[model samples]
Target: MFTRIRMVVLATNAEGSPDLFLTTVDATGTQYEHGRHYDMALPRARDEGYETPMIAFDQYDAAARMLRRAATFIEGGDAATGN
Candidate 1:
């Protein structure tokens, strides 16, 4: 059977909130996905999910940023490993 599941948060972005990524998955082997390796960053990355003064990182590494944000950022899930 196919499943309609919510998008899982991959990681906190350079911005202070969850990086906005969504997907529709065909869990069963009957259907095939159309896209591969799709990535989007706006004309400029923008703050999301919260308007308050949340802390953001300036680092290039996502995992390193997450580690630095340990006290400040709320992790989405384990997918932040960039796996």
Candidate 2:
């Protein structure tokens, strides 16, 4: 399985609040690879029972910018230790 820090935004709903539905992304490799991981995650979620709206990190968005920075940190660390 992939590992990464995920940011989830929860909103209140009539169904007892704290609805457990959110998207995820892998915090490894370049931003492009991160996106690839996201792409696979979406369909997997639908298969497992996720009907809520999800947010994707696009190329020119702040989320993508943040992922890029994270990618730099992760990639830089990997290179240093010969991963």
Candidate 3:
């Protein structure tokens, strides 16, 4: 429970039938980072020496989203410019 929460994944206890609450499953030790902070900082991140966030390999969707945010920052899109 100490680890950062990326997904609120849960499994119902139909087989064992735990009362009051469902069980938690830790399938992968490799956790995915949610980059909202990085997204918000995108406008000035590069200027301040903050590189674009990195998602894990084969995670094309997350990678694409990060790229799009960087692109927006570069293009002067909706992201607020200036420090």
Top-TM-score candidate index: 2
- Cα lDDT tens digits for candidate 1, 1-83: 66442222344555555543333333332321422111122112222333232232222335445554552434543443433
TM-score attained by model 1: 0.22
Question: Per-residue lDDT of 1-83 in model 3, one digit per residue for the tens?
Answer: 23322221112233433212212222232322443323322333233333334222222345445545766777777643421
Candidates in order have lDDT scores of 0.34, 0.49, 0.33
After superposition on all C-alphas, the RMSD of every candidate to the true structure, in Å, is 11.0, 11.3, 18.1
- Model 2 lDDT tens row, 1-83: 45553543323334544333345655556644546655645564455455446443434457655655666667775533343
Regions more than 4 Å wrong, model 2? 1-31, 56-83
Instruction: State the weakest 10-residue window (summed lDDT) of model 2.
Output: 5-14
Candidate topping lDDT: 2
TM-scores of all candidate predictions against the true structure: 0.22, 0.31, 0.23
Model 3: residue 51 alpha-carbon error in angstroms: 17
| Error in Å for residue 73 of model 1 | 18
Query: Using alpha carbons, what is the TM-score of model 3?
Result: 0.23
Model 2 TM-score relative to the real fold: 0.31
Q: Candidate 3: misplaced stretches above 4 Å?
A: 1-59, 80-83
The residue pairs found clashing in candidate 3 are none
Q: Which clashing pairs does model 1 show? A: none
Among all windows of ten consecutive residues in candidate 1, which has the lowest summed lDDT? Answer: 35-44
